[model samples]
Target: MRYAKFSMDDPFISMAEVRALVEGEVHFLAGVALLPDGREKIASRSSTVKVSGKLLSASHDPKEVNEAIRGRCFSIYPDVILGRDKNMFRALYSEATKGVETSKRCPKLDLVFTDGVIVAGIREEERDSKSLREHSMKPFSQSGTMDPFTSRLMVNLARVRKRVLDPFVGVGSILLESAWMGLDCVGVDVDPSMVTKAKANLSHFNYQCHVIQGSVTSLNLVGGFHVVTDPPYGRSSSAKGATLRELYAAFLSVSAELMERGGRLVFASDSREDWRDEIRSAGLKTVSTHLIYLHKSLSRAIYVVERG
Candidate 1:
């Protein structure tokens, strides 16, 4: 088994997003998760580690903790450092590795502590936040453009192997991240200016993505695409002469037709209307929904839907 440490950026949303990315059973424990081994590569914006064992209900005694680390470090090479939730516990590092380093292997063991519970493991994968930030701050940015981390999460949630489509790609935030993940991305925007800006942003990052000025409702694109986008929320952005409900219904209706069978659609919106009927009527199934509380009076809902 492996333990995955999640970013505290809305743990509920993070957990839900991670659940969609990872296969097999996943059990949650506070801010950490126990995932099946060999399935760690699918993790994005989260760190996965090989779990050696756990010190359940650990006491406050530092010596006992050091002893536990020593026992688990017997097989670990190139030394093992004491870490608490991805942060190094330098005070205990010396004590934990008194004589553990007996080889020259590069991989080190990480002992993660959450709520006084210690989980010994080796760090395997984590998201590149620095690059994500650089891509998000493009030449042109808008108010409702999706955040870089959330964009990556949505793309990963879609589980697209090669390509993704964004019907409402404003400034190309989602497309940028999608291309960074080595996926071919295409985006369409109703406004010509927004389309130009999106194309420029992708070019600035040297990502060859396709950005077109067209309405999503009338988009006649190839089928078999995993659609992931953040539709305009009707605030700080135009709804294209349609109510939020009607806009979503039309988008879902067309997206359902474009996406391949079993292709997933992950979108975020501020609309509170239940889209179950509209989603089902469009030949799609609602996989899951997550409410992200941004602040007072503004919470966004992330919907995960799949073509049936």
Candidate 2:
């Protein structure tokens, strides 16, 4: 399990979200070239299964990355992202916990390090750098949002071939994240604007995706997903004006359809509604639950759920 753990780029919150995103796995780490949409990012979509052939994984602890890739040829470079401050080189070095200095001119990372310490740097053409800028994002935009949190999740989804579904695909944020991570994402949304917005957002990054304007209860979902997680806002969307009992029933049905046998199903929802019965009816068992503060109005709960 050499998967990488991507840290949530939220300055206000700690790396706990990132830790949960990878389920305590670390292999590699890279700060995004961009800061994501300047809005609140719930989670950093990450690749859970670390594929050896592709040679990439999720890692949050810089020490873990340093220890794992110590003897191997490595390069630590920041993406020449547009919106982020040029000072990210320092922050990334700090996160890597390595006292390394990189210039602003170089974009693609190409270098070699000794004991997590940078010995020398190289240009894009230098070293064994396989310069593949095929997925470069378009100009920065404040129109849609995607912080490091969602991006990490998307990458993890790219690592496997499974039913990738998002129940509450508001503007297809997670879908965009998954697409970049190299996975085919299917998004279900009730709002047509969200579908359009998702397409626009995906187009901004020059990505192709599948978006469905529909409800979660009866989603056009085909197969089971490898990892299914979404920030369900009852107070705002699906749960609005409905009783807890009614909401849970709806969630149970949708959740069940989203997962396959032994598929990892993680969902974040407000605790205002009871989940005891829904957990059972959905044929999913609770693994862990954490209290999260999603602003003041909504109470956030991250539940590690699995289909049994």
Candidate 3:
């Protein structure tokens, strides 16, 4: 689909990270909505600009240096990058004059990815080619889940018109993500510590959340909830009482009972075993599975499960 990308408005923001995620120009221009590692809040969005220059005069004149530099080379961007401010250019140009041959540096308006053009904000070698998926065993800051991850999750919910639920609502990762995205969220967890943490985090972010401290099994939920969770993985579990297998089984059983006719569950989990087939047999239909890393053995499996 040839969608027009709008650059974020903040001329000084960093476009290095977001640029690597998608193939081309950004959906929004100027200020890009950025989701850094472990960030709950996707910060103000920023646009990207790649500038190239050559030292001149004494190999120092801005005009001569600028003239000698490759013009269209700006289009040949690095796979990994950042967009600097125009004000930042002065110091940069000054630095280059001092016998420092900077291949690429400084911010310029003429050079940018606008109108849906896919530019290399970062070069291939700089990017981690392993498919990157944003996740958290615990939710960020609490309120609204407005990052790229939550945005995508909400779209699925809205498209299916299915009420979303997060069974392992640690600090409200999934629920908070869904709620602020304008989807109804139902969260469950046995840990009182998590429930409170989730609530506090939600309040701090100023986003709304509907969470229960009861187990998903006994909740006897009404209506239907599409489950989505980031279950505790490895040493990240605050679930001191149960094994990883038991936690997953609870999720499997809950999906069988609470999900409506077309409900879905999208969650991240640590594998003690292949859980995809287990979830399917538990009355949920498997959709797609994406593998993501959350540190070491905590390799997360992002599952999209739908009710049969």
Highest TM-score among the candidates is held by which one? 1
The digit string of per-residue lDDT tens for model 1 on 168-193 reads 98888889888888888899999889
lDDT of each: 0.71, 0.47, 0.47
What does candidate 2's lDDT look like per residue over 262-290, in tens digits?
76665566667657577887677876565
lDDT of 2 at 258: 62
Best-fitting candidate, scored by lDDT: 1
**Per-residue lDDT of 1-308 in model 3, one digit per residue for the tens?**
11111223323222332432334434444432212223211221111222212211222234443443434243222111134344544453543234423344543212222222222221212211111133233344443322334324333432334477777776665555565456677778888887888787667657677878887556767857666666666544434476766667776887768777766666665544478667866877766655544456455555667776
Question: RMSD to native for every prediction?
Answer: 5.4, 10.4, 12.2
TM-score of 1: 0.79
Better of 1 and 2 by lDDT: 1
Model 1 ranges with Cα > 4 A deviation: 42-108, 235-240
- Provide the lDDT at 222 for model 1: 87
Candidates sorted on TM-score, descending: 1, 2, 3
Error of 3 at 176 (Å): 2.0
The whole-model C-alpha lDDT of candidate 1 against the native structure comes to 0.71
